[model samples]
Target: MTPQEWVTSGDDQAGDIPSPVGFRILIKPYRLPKFSAGGIALVGESKQYADIAKVAGQVLKMGSECYRGERFSAPWCKIGDYVIFPKHAGQTIEVKRNDGQDPDQYLLVNDDEIRAVVKDPSQIKAYL
Candidate 1:
């Protein structure tokens, strides 16, 4: 919910993070590789992320793409992060850290609504 919606609801504080559901997520480690800098690695096996065509864009998921329609956006999800989507109503999905054997999909990490994973403080602060 947006800030205004959250406040009008009055059920809880806006600062209290809601659950994450139906969100295209980005999975990543709380602490990323300062060494790797820019590279794609599998989810879990490494902290590296998959740098894709729209990796650094502001909008995590634009809802439509020229080639890949409704593609899952946001590759920076992590444990305890809240996610939301139309598919999942009334409940949100919280991103949890998983161990992936492959490094290539590290950038693929996971899917959620948020721009980046809650694991990345940088990404979280931006939303705040």
Candidate 2:
């Protein structure tokens, strides 16, 4: 499906939701505290990670000027790229999800706030 169709389709299968505009990019942060280095499951440590971890997120959508903007003038990342950002980098917004908890949280960050892109997000170390 086309990007426009994906955005408007209202299907919450973990891919295709909202589209960002201008210099904003939508990122879905990776789940934190799933397990510890010592092989202990951090079942309820999500809150701790959310409070004090620089997050790695998969890029969902890129704004029109993300690659060629008047502000930054060069693109360092693209859609589907994994990115690292500060713990307080972007504005957090929740979107509806298939899971019946609170809406899934997504970060809306400017192109400049993206620190680095990763080939494999799982390889990045998660802090406790």
Candidate 3:
């Protein structure tokens, strides 16, 4: 099924995130690394540094108008794709889950903000 269809589907729905309406993208940022390359645990300031270091994320959804502009062409990224965007390019949104646990954080970014696409985010050394 297409990303849009899957999201709007009714089967066992946990809840829906804010659907990107225009040239927008919904992404779930990869969690920061818990330990450094040396295997030492990162604390307070270190953890904060790790968090801000990430510019990669998983594409959760996209707006219908994404890449469809009068001057632009087509979109390069799709749902489920790993994309690299500018640091601090998107807005943070808290999503309330149906399981009643803590809300998850998501980024709402414009399609134009995406800089590059990676097949596997895990392959990124910084993230690993």
Query: 1 or 3, which is superior by TM-score?
Result: 3
Model 1: per-residue lDDT, tens digit, 15-84? 3222222433332212333244355444653333222211221112222221233563433433434332
Q: What TM-score against the true fold does each predicted structure earn?
A: 0.16, 0.70, 0.73
Number of the top TM-score candidate = 3
Native-vs-model 3 lDDT?
A: 0.74
Find the candidate with the highest lDDT and give its number: 3
lDDT of each: 0.28, 0.70, 0.74
Candidate 3 residue 16 C-alpha distance from true site, Å: 3.7
Error of 2 at 94 (Å): 0.7
- Per-residue lDDT over 11-116 for candidate 3, one digit per residue giving the tens place of the 0 to 100 score: 2434567888888899877655556658888889878766677777789889898988675766779998888888779899987767776666779999889988
lDDT score for residue 106 of model 1: 16
| TM-score (C-alpha, index-matched) for candidate 2 | 0.70
Clashing pairs in 3: none
Q: Score candidate 1 by lDDT.
A: 0.28
